[model samples]
Target: MLYIGIDLGTSAVKLLLMDETGRIHNVVSREYPLFFPHPGWSEQNPEDWFEQTLAGLEELVSGADRDKVAGISFGGQMHGLVILDENDAVIRPAILWNDGRTVKETDYLNQEIGRDRLSEYTANIAFAGFTAPKLLWVRDNEPENFARIRRIMLPKDYLCYRLSGTFATDLSDASGMLLLDVKNRRWSKEMLEICGVTEDQLPQLFESYEKVGTLKPELAKRLGLPEAVVIAAGAGDNAAAAVGTGTVGDGRCNISLGTSGTIFISSRQFRVDSNNALHSFDHADGTYHLMGCMLSAASCNKWWMDDILATKDYAGEQADITKLGENHVFFLPYLMGERSPWNDPMARATFTGITMDTTRADLTQAVLEGVCFATRDMYEIARSLGVHVDRTKICGGGAKSPLWRRMIANILNIKVDVPACEEGPGMGGAMLAMVADGVYATVEDAANAIVKVRETEEPDPELVAKYEERYRQFRTLYPALKPVFQEIAK
Candidate 1:
């Protein structure tokens, strides 16, 4: 049997076709536009997502054995607010996860309502990117649209509804919405009341590997697939990426350095930190995981190389960065504000300690090191919670760079394992589909069978020691600049 994985990303929908044995047969990607109506606000049309996904699926399965396709699943960008009217038509453009227009709503939740109550209700506090804040924003700013809302859906759930005619979401994705009692894996009643929404407005919840419904006959037929094709409940992008990298079971970790950077740690038990800095969310594997997300990572490098330096030669620029841990210049990787430990959307990127003697290599190296240093901040938080992580699997675009991988391993003082297949969330989505199809008994079984390690980068004591000192200084810069960032934003 064959399985299909759809990764509904911010810029594009990536589709993957895989066989029962985990061999990828075909892959297709379709790009869509991201709209910004106001400064710091991000939105996308749900119809664009469905249309692109439909077209991508048609292309993905074109040369494959259509009759053998058994299931389809998804991994998508989380925390986007999609609403539908009574007629099931989209009410408005989706407010995306990267959107930062919910400052007022977020402040109201974190201050007026209080973070303690929120953490009690949902096991997480309000962030500008969270769905609860977005809902509150819509209610306050667009009351007319809010009045028309019949259903609330996340980005991928919209696609799931279009494909399977089922309004459903997986635990991992719902956990990020600030509407789930994550510790218990259910919608939080208090949050529903707080957001002025009812449980009926939300989608039915399922574990990521569970089957939601069969594909709609029209969609299946259009794609030349069987009507019986199972539609598995999918996961949030990071959790899906973790599954693809085989970072399941207790003590497993996966670090993703895409546009956003995330440190994902899987656990059999549910745990939340004292400060709620790390997200306590349900895992795609029917367990639980803690994640720390940084708003910018690889984008920092992109900004420096393309926007600042006016060149697309990322490797050419990085080639001169031979001095690993001794650069005097330091950078703060907060290009799009920040999340995780800081949670400050006002924070701005800075290049500090640059001397007249600083070379281009020194500045370039700082950007990479800054990202690694921020990653270590999350690792320290996990360690403080008594979750010992000796190693982590690395994935995403930045993981392809050997220098960045080495920096991550040394700076975090952990063994960094690289996966043979780095398809990230798309691959994980297919694996979930295989589980739903009964080709694998469990998510863990599917992960263990499919994920293969290509190589490992072990931390060196000398390099680790140097990075340790550098990280100490890097951690202090954020606090020193906090008030400055706030003032500038005002």
Candidate 2:
């Protein structure tokens, strides 16, 4: 039998076709537009996701044995607010996970409502991108739309509903909504009441590998799939990527350098740090994981190269950056504001310590190095929590850069393992589908069999020492500029 993995990303819907053996038969990607109405605001149309996904799924399974396609699942961007009216019509453009328009609402949740209360209810303090804060923003700003909202869903859960005719979301995805009582694997009553929402407004919760329902009959037929094709509730992108890299069990780590960067540490037990710097969310494997997410990662490099430098040659720009951690220039990668340890929406990207001698290469290197430095900031938090990580599995667009991987290795002072096949969330979604179809007994069993490490990038003691000093300097910049950032916002 065959399975399909649908990764509904911020920019595209990536569809993958796989067999029970985890062999990828075919893959297709369809791009969509991302909207920015305000400086830090991000949104997308729910209809766009469904339309492209429909096209991508058709192309993905085109040459495969259609009758043998047994299951379909998803891995998607988390925390996006996708509300629907009573007739199931989309209320507005989806407020995305990267959106920072909820700063006012986030402040109300964390400062006014109290971070301790939020942590007690949701195991996380409110970030500008979280759904609960977005809910409050809508209620405060768009009262009419808020009144019309009959259902609330995440970006991927909307796909789950459209495809399977089931209003369901996997626990891993729901954990980011800031509504789920993550440790208990249920919605928090306190959060629901605070957001002025009911339990009925949310989707039914399921484990990542659980079969929610069969695909909608007409839609299944349209995609050349059988009516019996099981639809499994999938995971959030980072958690799903962890599953794809086989980073499960206790104290396993994976670093993702996509549009947003994240250091995900999977654990068997539930634990939250004193400051709540890292998010304590349910994992795709039905356990729990601590994740630190940065709003900008690869996007910083993209912005520098495409928008600032006005060039398409990203590699050419990086070729001259051989100085490593010895550079005097530094960059703060807070273009869309920051998350994880900082959680400061007022933060903005900056290039500090540039002199007359600084070339384009120096600035370029700073952008890449800055992202690595920010990642290390999150790593330091996990270290403080006694989560010792000697090595990490790496994935995403930025991980393709040999220079960036070396930087991450030395900065984090850990061996970086590159997976044999790094399809990330898409692969994990298919693996979850395999489990839901009974192709595997469990997600771990599926991962152990399917995921393999191709290569390891080991850290150099000399480079690590140099980066240690660089990171120490990087840490101070955030604190010094934080007040300035707040003032700038005002």
lDDT for every model?
0.93, 0.93
Give the per-residue lDDT digits (tens) of candidate 2, residues 180-209.
Answer: 999999999999999999999999999999
- Alpha-carbon TM-score of each model against the true structure: 0.99, 0.99
Report the lDDT tens digits of candidate 1 across residue range 275-308: 9899999999999999999989988998899899
For candidate 1, the per-residue lDDT at 212 reads 94
Question: What C-alpha RMSD separates each model from the true structure?
Answer: 0.9, 0.9
Supply the TM-score for candidate 1.
0.99
> Which portions of model 1 show Cα errors greater than 4 Å?
none
| Candidate 2 lDDT score at position 460 | 96
lDDT of 1: 0.93
TM-score, candidate 2, is 0.99
